[model samples]
Target: MSSAGGPAIGTITTEVPARLDRLPWSRWHWMIVVGLGTVWILDGLEVTVVGNIASRLSESGSGLPISDSQVTGLGAALYVAGACSGALVFGWLTDRFGRKKLFLITLAVYLASTAMTALSFSAWWFFLFRFLTGFGIGGEYAAINSAIDELIPSKYRGRVDLIINGSYWLGAMGGALLSVLALDTGIFPENIGWRLTFALGVVLGLVILLVRRHVPESPRWMFIHGQSDGANAIVEGAEKEIEEETGAPLPKAGRAITIEQRRSISFVEIGRTLFRAYPKRATLGFSLFIGQAFLYNAITFGFSSILVKFFGVSSGTTGYFFAVIAFGNFLGPLLLGRLFDTVGRKKMISGTYILSGLLLFVTAWLFDQGWLNATTMTVCWCVVLFFASAGASSAYLTVSEIFPMETRAMAIALFYALGTAAGGISGPLIFSGLTSSGVVSDAVVAFCIGAALMVAAGVVAVLFAVDAEGKSLEDIARPLSQRTKPTGRPAGPPSAPAV
Candidate 1:
């Protein structure tokens, strides 16, 4: 048992970690991360495109009754609302059905909804379609992430997930570029831009479907679901390719657990596990999730909010400009992908939190001082997003690893749902309410408040976070090695890390 009164080594059954050095990765691993990440990117592209288009809707030829900002915020609100609902429902479904199945299904929903959204005309039609699209994206968040956690090898999981997670910015950047280019063309009318932007999403979705034929299921989930026969089939398939190259016996299984920590998982059951496991991991998971939900979403969703109203930028200029910022955000993760291994999860995450806060403060300061003009402000926002995305990307990686695989998805869903649901609702709401209330005049003032919130996020991580880099799932879950005291207290994540 752990020093904290959790499971002892002999208490529950789990696979033993093999030396990562001996393992060879097949294309399957990369495909899973990149493929799933690409789906998220498409979702991100659609979202950014919606933001670009919503800002122009009322002024477009269709003549929707609402103002562009109103449509944008309302569409976002509906989107977030759909996500909140999707998270609650799909988080459970992903856990119950397994990640890969749900991942593919959610992609289909997103593709269909994006097509519907493109065809929207009236305000109600647009709102409904966007809400549905957000709902699918919400489902994607849980399924894609859970699938990545289960599919990838433990040693490289964090880095893989980070790079994949980082691709959300790629989608955003793609949308921004397309929107800008389409707008600059002048051949297309104003309303046509939104349609073309959404059409790009359809193309991306089709690409995922074609490539998805090559993707595989989660062997871990198969193992847990009493499908060891099926899991072995997958392992054997991966093994065959490796053996071909190395001319050797592809290594075999970990020490299997006698008693699985997870029994039956449902959404309500997940809630029970989070609180009932009375596990520190569970509680810490919730807190970290809550903190991230409050900060990350607020910052991401609030970006357009700041640009449109607080920054006093014209509608025509904002979408194309924001696109550049999105490109940097995409690069931040893809370029720095290796740091999770070299720097260690604790320091990598801690540094990201602190640095993001510092950047946020800079953005706020520049805006408050009237030093950041449109060009400068856009650059600063992108830089802040780059760092913020880094920190935000890790929250899922850490949260999934902290729990045992038995309850891993449940824990992930619960924590993510709690944070994201709260965040999904709060981010746009807070920015709109606070800014519209006139409590803050400058965009920097609002950003200052955001930076302060991020500072809290930094403090939380440094105090609670532990380094998980290079550790196996078992090493993380019960921590057999570290807590070198009277009783074996596995080293937990340092206090914790958040958005």
Candidate 2:
């Protein structure tokens, strides 16, 4: 392994970013996707398992000494708090050290924390472990998003990011299915079944860690940090592999942007970039993130409760319904993701957000009219989330793409922390209260609120979203330290036929 070593402080210009962007897709890209994208699945699995087993955790025979409210309420709050804190701390570290390093460390943190969660006997212990688990997952978001955007070709960046982030729903579906088996009393003891759920996620994380070990550091980060030799080696290796796979010549390298290399970046500069230099983009990021966070956290946290309260559904059966909904969520990104590249980011982003919000509104009205049963309501939710899921995933894609390279991780961390703080904490509490009220009108009001926010976010997207589709990260926002300026040409036009 090359030491990702670079200068302490200096200036350098390199075409490493252009070289990486010009390469045709090959097995190497898929390897990057699988190794890095699995974190979201682990996150979705952990979250879904905990939500599905909240009832089991509260049972006297489940070994954990915790009430249902404690498990679902306080525990969830601690996890979100930890995630928010971790993003800030790790986001800065990712920018300072390197993407590959922090991503590996974060996954290790998640594997260790989640494995420990199965051994927790008391509520405090369980809460602590959950927080630690979230902390790791939060760090993964910052590190992985940066690395993926840097490595993936700009032309395919949108769809790749959407699909990768959307992989969260795949994990959700897996968790829902696993919960049905693991939570079944016939299969295992009450205490052991739920424990097995946490263990399942740990096993998956371990596999991902092994795969990630073969993944390399972001060469773009290396070049900017004054490690030209290391960056050139990586890009050359990738080009060779890709050419062998495609059996053709690679595209002409694009013009390189010159940049000043710095060993350290201050939080003050990151803040300046967001609020001072790119205020509208900053606003767009907040609106998208907060709206999606509120909608997702609310529904995901209260999904089973809604089924039980409104439709006389059982705890065990909720997983099946949620699984069906999770499938819809996954399909949204897989099917529609390509449009983000071809149709353009702003239009597609706005369309998904607004359309999903409208669907949710219609679904809310149907529920209020007493026209929905468990099956029909699940179907409606599936339709609504099919669009909302894509929109939500795009929010992460948006924040990750629109910022400068120096503060890219921190920018994502900033929006995620703020959005999660605003919506992630209060959303579940509000929805839980509404669902528990036994009044359809109360639940209807909650749904309407989420719908309205989604619509507003869509409007914001229309007004403020960056037209970043098929654009390089460097083209989208020049690095803070970039000394050379562009002269009306994109990092050179595509030099080879689109593969």
Candidate 3:
């Protein structure tokens, strides 16, 4: 061929940007976030508010009417029971059905259950409502996290999810505010505080419905599961809109990956894929899942109780203290986001693990020396929570990113289910058991253990985990990265998928 005016035989251009598979934060992102946030907030409230409410319930001779010890024991029991159910049920449903549909159904159950509990005539009713709410919460935790992980650009995935999840702190603060205000009025803490607080969940659920209406079924998932038409439509619509606004050529489409007709894959196949196809990622997911569960449950469930019992803070004061602590939680993820993208994934997460551990060690020392009494304790806890939020958020984001759309829900659920069920149950079980058995002074011990575990997990992650920040999802989830090792991993698609 002539060099100057002649046509080349094999010249090609990619119309799609590398970032297409990953979506930027837009109005769609916000709408879906609100949907996910509502579910997450309720989950946070359900776990955290129990400590404050247990005291209220016990004093009023309502629902179990147990002593402080009994309240802790039963609440822990109920929570674990529900969480176990969640890990099993919701994760399965999320993968088997559509994320968008399951989103609606789970919220309805949460709203109805919480509303019923608010008007309960006795403790039995309250207990039942809590169990049901717990169930809804369990399912939602798995679904929303998986959905958002698949919905966004791999590069921006961590920040999008972190911001979405950071709203959980806002939810906790709301609960704390309500707890303090009610207790101060001498109305809620006396007999009906827990009831009113739970009703707030119903309001949250209603709001979720409005927001979720805007969230489409996960496009990545649709493509993976043979919903090609649905997947193409979601991507094409977004592309047309982007082109109109930016005046750019349409995004490039990758080599065709036809959605084959076949019987639905079995759960065992998903499990085998996790364990065999990508064992290291599976292990990473497991460690992060369990470690975070330990960290979060310890803080959320045990903090209020320690405030009331050791510090002698009034219920209102405790609420304010908890709210301040959560403010740190809300900020932690945002701060981490800036570094998470620039620094490689391992560097950022490994740092979070070490820093979080050190912070908690300092937090424990402050609490032990009585240096953190009341106001100081709240301040100290906030600092600790900030670091903890960073580690926890990174863990969740990584888990979501490490798996593919075909098995992402199951992969996420497997770790989350095992870790959350164990850690969620363990936090309350340990605190209540120690309190009842006189084995320990307070809940601070849980933080100490959590920090140590995080350090260990961080070390493991750095040693084995691959850096995934800024990579494509298809590339990130490819088994050959490790399974077919020694042939250095390749970078980028010749053409990118229309995200």
Backbone collisions counted per model = 16, 0, 6
How much is the lDDT of residue 78 in candidate 1?
A: 79
Q: Regarding TM-score, does 1 or 3 come out ahead?
A: 3
Q: What is the TM-score of each candidate against the true structure?
A: 0.85, 0.95, 0.86
In the range 1-499, model 1's lDDT, one tens digit per residue, is 2234322221223232232223566665667666777886886687676666555666636445556545545666778778766765677787667777887788888889889888876778878888888778878777777777666676678778887888887888787667666554376776676677888898889898777757777666654554444555766666676677677876545333333323245556555555665355554455455555655555555455466665677656676777788877777777666788778777777677678778888777767666766678888877877777777788778777876555666566667767666655666566555555533344445566567656666666776676777776655664222122222222122331000
Cα-based RMSD of the predictions, in order? 7.4, 3.9, 7.5
Alpha-carbon runs more than 4 Å astray in model 3: 1-19, 22-24, 61-64, 186-189, 245-263, 435-444, 479-499
* TM-score top scorer: 2
The CA root-mean-square deviation of candidate 3, after full C-alpha superposition on the true structure, stands at 7.5
Candidates ranked by lDDT: 2, 3, 1
Per-residue error (Å), model 2, residue 468: 0.5
CA lDDT scores, all candidates in order: 0.65, 0.87, 0.66
lDDT of 2 by residue, 89-151 (tens): 899999999999999999999999999998998888999999999899889999999999999
Model 1: ten consecutive residues of lowest lDDT: 490-499
Candidate 1 C-alpha error for residue 193, in Å: 2.1
Query: Per-residue lDDT tens digits of candidate 3, residues 1-499?
Result: 1134422212122212233553444565566677676676776676657766656656644444556654565655576567568656877888777688777787887888788877876556666777787777767767788788766766677677776777778778777777776555455435555667777778877877887888888765554444545655776677666666666674444323222222245788787887887888877777776777777775566666676777776655677788788778989887877667777778877777777778777877766676767788778767777877877877767777787556666666677777776676676677665444433335557668877877777787787676877766666774211222112223223542222
Off by over 4 Å in 2: 1-8, 487-499
Q: Residue 438 in candidate 1 has what lDDT?
A: 35
- In candidate 2, the residue pairs with backbone N, CA or C atoms under 3 Å apart (3 or more residues apart, or in different chains) clash, namely none
Report residue 350 deviation for candidate 2 (angstroms): 0.9
